[model samples]
Target: MPDLLTDRLLLRPWRESDLEPWAAMNADPEVRAQLGELLTREQSDAVVAGMRADFDARGFGWWALQVRATGEFVGRAGLDVVGADLPYTGVDVGWRLRRSAWGNGYATEAALACLAFAFDELALEEVVASTTVRNVRSQAVMRRIGMTRDPADDFEDPSVPEGPLRACVLYRKQAR
Candidate 1:
């Protein structure tokens, strides 16, 4: 997939250099809270490896996000198949940024761009995003990107342990 650019961010393919910071970001407790667990460096490395392979085979997956002017890796935001069984199934949009990058509207900006890519470039009819009910921050990002939540579509994420993270909220946006 071609790189996507907004006024302040660039969504592009991952680079070898991103591994260290990516691992650090994944290891952050605040970030991991939404994800339900912190990832080890090796686990984070494996994720990057899998994403790189996905991009190689599919032409699109999660893209590394950066500050275009500074070239600093903020985090990743892009499209991917919703791998787990859920009430909805198809391509989904997601984002994660360093703690320093939070409250900057970067997630909303990058997600909107990915939605455009999904609806226009890929001609997909819809895109979905889900987060634990506790993750109000991510739900806010979903709302900012014009996704709407339907209570009827919400479900417990089977992959999560039965605890604070198990109950999930789902949101979706249809191409206009």
Candidate 2:
């Protein structure tokens, strides 16, 4: 897919240079708080590689997000096909920003761009997002992008080991 530009953010494909900071972000305890355990360097690079492959195969996946003016890699934001074992199946919007990038409105900005691409470019009818019930920050981003949630849609993520992160809440936005 082509690069998506917001007023302050650029959503583009992963880069080779992103490995170091990406690994650093993944290793941060605060950044990993809602996602999962900290990942090893190999594990982090593998994620970027997988994102590149997924975009090549399907034309859309997580984009390596950057600040347009400073050209700093802030984090990642994009869509992924929800795993089939989940209670529901659909494209899910996601973002992972560096700790320094938090509370800067970057996630909301990038997410709105991705949501527009999902609806306006790809013609998808809906997109979803889910996180652990404790991940209120991500849920706030979801709401900021106009996604809504139904209490009944919340379910346990079987893949996540029993922990605070296992109980997930689902949110969705429909094409307008």
Q: Quick one: best lDDT, which candidate? A: 2
Model 1, range 49-157, lDDT digits (tens) per residue?
Answer: 9998997887778999999989999999999998756667999899999999999999999999999999999899999999999999999999989999999888898
List runs of model 2 lying over 4 Å from the truth: none
Model 2 global lDDT (CA atoms, 0 to 1): 0.94
Q: Write the per-residue lDDT of candidate 2 for residues 1-176, one digit (tens) a residue.
A: 79999999999878788899999999999999988899999999999989999999988999999999999999999989999899999999999999999999999999999999999988999999999999999999999999999999999999899989999999999999
In angstroms, the error of model 2 at 147 is: 0.7
Best by TM-score: 2
Which parts of model 1 are misplaced by more than 4 Å? none
Could you tally the backbone clashes for each prediction? 0, 0
